[model samples]
Target: MEQLKKLDKIKVAIADDLDFFRKVLVDIFEEEEEFIVSGVYKNGQELIKNIFAIKPDIILTDFKMPDGDGLYVIEKINEMKYNIPVILISSYAKQDNEGILECLEKGAVDIIEKPTEQSFKASFDLLKTSLLKKIRYIYNNCVVLNQVKTVESKTTDYIAIGASTGGTKAIETIMRDVKRLSKTTIFISQHMPARYTTAFAQRLNSICSNGITEAINGEKIKSGHCYIAPGNFNLIFAGDHIELTDASKQIVSPGIDIMFQSFVSEAEKTCGILLTGMGSDGATGLKKLHDHGAITVVQDERSSVVYGMPKSAIEIFIVDYILPLNLIAGFINSISQ
Candidate 1:
């Protein structure tokens, strides 16, 4: 909670139709020293009409609200040219639905999945804690980030990314700034449950300048569009296309090493970018890619929420450039040019 001390005393608003949820959320805020709950609304229309008066530091809203949904709240905020970051709470993480993604593109900062069990005692505590942590992160980021987009530069034929924990925002920022992504194929091995990966892909696509989608089995890797290896499966390159295999059996599906190994075999003359993420997932794979003539870059500790992945890569001498998130675009652009 030390990292969150700075966030105590910020204004917040909750827009959900459920009385129980509102009560629980208000209780959590009251217990926190820094959080001040300004208003609670039963519908999107009520919040939209009065939110300007509250001018909350952050907003937490349910996906389905009376009159309008969370997406509507995002739209209303954007229409006013306000930078209020709304976190959308949804009940699903499967089937690749675009409902949450739609709100993100419209200006929602993030989304979290609420449990479907309908038992508040089982889930409310976790939800409240996670939401509080998320709000603090969002507030700090807004203070530091003048722009939501990443800087743009050159892209290479080979790309690899890894993420966990706070990787969602990192991926969105990178994709938003990558205006000139090369036609070469890119692969990401993120640490997440399979059902959640689809949502993550959708979120990335919403903010990215180019295209991004969840990878299908035996699909050919192409340029302009970013590919995420399906959940619970490792993505391996087979000649020109990619394959997803059961990670539980092989013990490494959707893994950075496996993805890079496949790429190095087929395209050693490519570039690899390992962004913010947890664990040493990409370190070994990046070293192999570097050994095979691939350009390698890792995010710096300061820019990374968790420096494990990039730190391992740098220590192993697998990363040729250790740069900040913002400078990565320019560095690659200069070299690629």
Candidate 2:
């Protein structure tokens, strides 16, 4: 019971031109003690007019509103420099639509796939759960942004990051803000099953500043590209290039230790960022990098999903900087630059 109450309650406003959908979203919030429905606007214009008065924590708005739409609301927020976080809902989220991309560029933080086929009652009920997770991530990202101010690091040959559960959102937030330095590359190890790597890369590439893709076997790992380790294999460097191969053990999933160990063979001055996650998959790998004079950073315990990895790394005296997920980008820039 105590743990259940730890979730933060957030104020929210729903904006959609559809009358039934607007009330449904509002009802979803009213049903949860963890969320407060501050206002319901039928169109983007009404939302823009009353946002100042409501001052909600998050905005859940549909893209088909009158007067304005999701894109318009996003543009206005950016033009006005509003600090609020907005989550855009559209049926196109499931499709390969550019609307989601445009929303991100305009300042909306997360995009959700709204069920267009479902009736208002069913869709709103489902949204209650999904919105909770998205809003938590958004609020947490907001918390980190307040702490870390710098956007990009100084120029370096490479940057490497390692993480597990909760890493997806963390990595996306970091990548969105970091401006690419010329001739720099990034390597990442996110412990996902073999089935998810391609979609992960495609989805990640949408938000990242640099090109993002799954590591192909024998690929000549080079600077300026972001390499995501292919799932179900050990991603390591055999000769200063990424080599995707099966782990020596019966363990089928791709691991992180070999990835960091091999990369540190030559790129000793690189920056290593370990983010919010569970387990110890990345601790050994990060420590290996730290031993080679790399600038090592581990997410602080307070902001982590599970502190296992960072905790182990810190105990070994390998992590040079202890920061929250947001502070990591700034710390990287300060050191690399």
Highest TM-score, which number?
2
**What is the per-residue lDDT of model 1 for residues 1-337, given as tens digits with 9 covering 90 to 100?**
0111233378888888878767877898999888899889987788889976876777888888669778888888766645566888766535436876677656576788766546667887788889888887766644311122122233356667766656777777666755556665557777777788898888888777668899999887676668887789888877677788788664433677777777787445567778787778878877887787777777777678988888888887835565556445444444341
- For each candidate, give its TM-score against the true structure: 0.52, 0.54
- Candidate 2 lDDT tens digits, 189-256: 88778788789888889877778888888888776778888787777766557787775463435676
Clashing pairs in 1: 8-34, 9-34, 154-333, 183-223, 233-253, 233-254, 234-253, 234-254
Model 1: worst 10 consecutive residues (lDDT sum): 143-152
Q: How high a TM-score does candidate 1 get?
A: 0.52
Give candidate 1 regions above 4 Å deviation: 1-155, 180-182, 249-253, 332-337
